[model samples]
Target chain A: MSGGKPLSRFHQPIEVPGRRLLHHIHLNFVKKKVVGGGGRSMNQEIPLIPFIDFLLCIVLFLLASFSASGELPIDKNVKLPNAMNAIEMMEAPIVAVTATQILVDGIPAGSTRAIIDSNTKQKIEELSEILKNKRELWKQLKPNEPFPGNVILQVDRKVPALVVKSVFQTAAFAGYPAVSFMVGRLAKE
Target chain B: MAGIDTGGGHGGKRSSNHEIPLIPFIDFLLCLVMFLLVTAVWSHMARIEADAKVPGPPREDEQDKIEPEKELHVHAKERKFQLVWKEGSTVVEESEVERVSVNVGDDVTFPELAKKIGKQWTDHGSHRAAADKKFDRAILHTDNNTEFGVVIAVLDAVYTPQREFLVGNKTEEVPAFHVTFAAK
Candidate 1:
């Protein structure tokens, strides 16, 4: 108790060492509080649930909202026709008919007039040959299954009905009975 | 607490609560968002089924069964439509002709023709006419000079009549007929 006596005016000279010792004790208490209790109790980990939520949102958007139809190349030359009531086109062989030329999946088969003139009676010869070749290739891949005779016909909005009808006939003659006209959605009237 | 504790027990000690390195993680998230946004396709392409009217040899029994078949011919002229009703391979007189011109707000308007035809079909109690009925199939005849958009508009009008039913909060469209195309 005498060693622990309070410092007074008379003890001021001896109190310098005591003050330094007291400073160390305060720092130790602070260090313990910082490292042991309140600081550790305050968890610093980034809340993983929000990051997980963001990841799940992105995954759901990618999986659920993605279009079922794969990308179909749009020809710059052919302005696709518009329709009020239309459904999404399925993936199939494409027959693109512009004003001047006809393309089978981006490859020029023949001139529009040539195909029409070659078979004035309905069956377009060149297009039918191209489609027939395609059908054969498809059949080779799936020998056990029947060929799904479907074609995606993309025609320019300015093209005449005659050319479109001829293409339709050619598709039918080529063993592809179903022709789906690829069209853009018409704006609301 | 006083004299001896300072030099005996305390020295330079470092803290252990190091901050998490988050810059790379944030960068990863930003890149992923950009990649998904850039590759996303928003617009949808649609299809309208087109079938060729192939002329084939008619069987004797098939001809006998179809001798009484009725047909409706829709001739799409410039700015007008001529509706001709056919009965059993015979073209009848008294055809109903209607005109479809561009409205004030639209570039091409042909739904009026569809509305008129729908009215006629409904008046005749043939709105739900079967596929075997002549009204169920419409032959759309158009010229080469006519715009394909106009033809499609007319086709839309014929195939999908404006009559709709409300199901819950959504309105449902009632489709009418299958259309065949003829070029002049």
Candidate 2:
């Protein structure tokens, strides 16, 4: 500890008479003169306090955001519709209807084109099978509690209403009646 | 130089005084900030509630029951939207209906459809009052080729409160409609 007075309680970089030693470590490309006080630096203090405050503000904003659920898995091909009146994301079985495919809980159940083309006036068999199993499992888990017939439908913007109707009917036919459309939230309410 | 200068003549070796590693702490904070920023965007996913009443097989005890509230439906077509008013869920036949023709390409026309919807609801408000019901519920009937963006736009428009009414000394904003995305 063979030193004079501490240059700063928050340490300041030590510099020479004409140049800063820390900065000169990189090869000086241009020969330029620097005006430096004896052993003191004329360099402005980096505004770290304000920078930290800004970061804190951003952190606070993100923390206080309406996403108690950290992140939802958004389908790659599906473009969600933007709505101002949508509520917070609800926890339920997601039936994602893309351009070509119909997915129940991220698992491919069937093709959208097939459902639209086939003239069968029936609920989607594959989707119904999976949902029925899920319903039974939920019932087994909580026998006393009644089934909360809620399912979320996340459909792509381009997909026609025909496919959406089919998916909706299939979900309801499987005993999940209370449906919620999963939409992307717009800027303001 | 990277580590903290602890046991030295820089300050007296007071047990309470310890040097905190600011560089590593700053590194951790940078990591946290990056993580929070990345995760924040996915939270934009929200939901619109709609009741899809697909009547199941009836039990022996329940037989004849008619729902009193009318299910007003807005049918979306390629170039026009048809508003169908029904007296009850049991009432299969459409009573009074109106149409608003709009080009599918023009997004502005969709909001106009919502305005028509609001006006229709206001006109029926008196009839609803006679029945002692606040019939703000509406159903959206969309067929094949109707864009989901257009559906959401119409639904959002309907969800917004259009009128503020003075009730007992306070101005209360009455919401336009609780929209149900009807699929049959």
Residue range A75-125, candidate 2, lDDT tens digits: 898888777667777778888889889888899987888866773334788
Question: What is the clash count for each candidate, in the order shown?
Answer: 0, 0
Q: Per-prediction DockQ, in order? A: 0.32, 0.46
Worst 10 residues of 2 chain B by lDDT: B125-134
Assess the local accuracy of residue A186 in candidate 2 as a C-alpha lDDT between 0 and 100: 67
Q: Candidate 1, residues B79-175: lDDT per residue as tens digits? A: 5677766665677533454675554233355677867667645543233523222235567787755666666777766655534545566655545
Q: After superposition, how far is residue A109 of candidate 2 from its true place, in Å?
A: 0.9
**Prediction 1 TM-score vs. true:** 0.68
**lDDT string, candidate 2, B87-136, tens digits:** 66454334322334343332322556656666777666333322223435
TM-score of 2: 0.65
Estimate every model's Cα lDDT from 0 to 1: 0.66, 0.68
TM-score of each: 0.68, 0.65
Q: For residues A1-189, what per-residue lDDT tens digits would candidate 1 score against the true structure?
A: 245465664655443332233234457667555555344453366675577568658856865656555467888888776676676678799999887888999888767766445544355667889999999999999999988788988888777676777787778778887777888776655
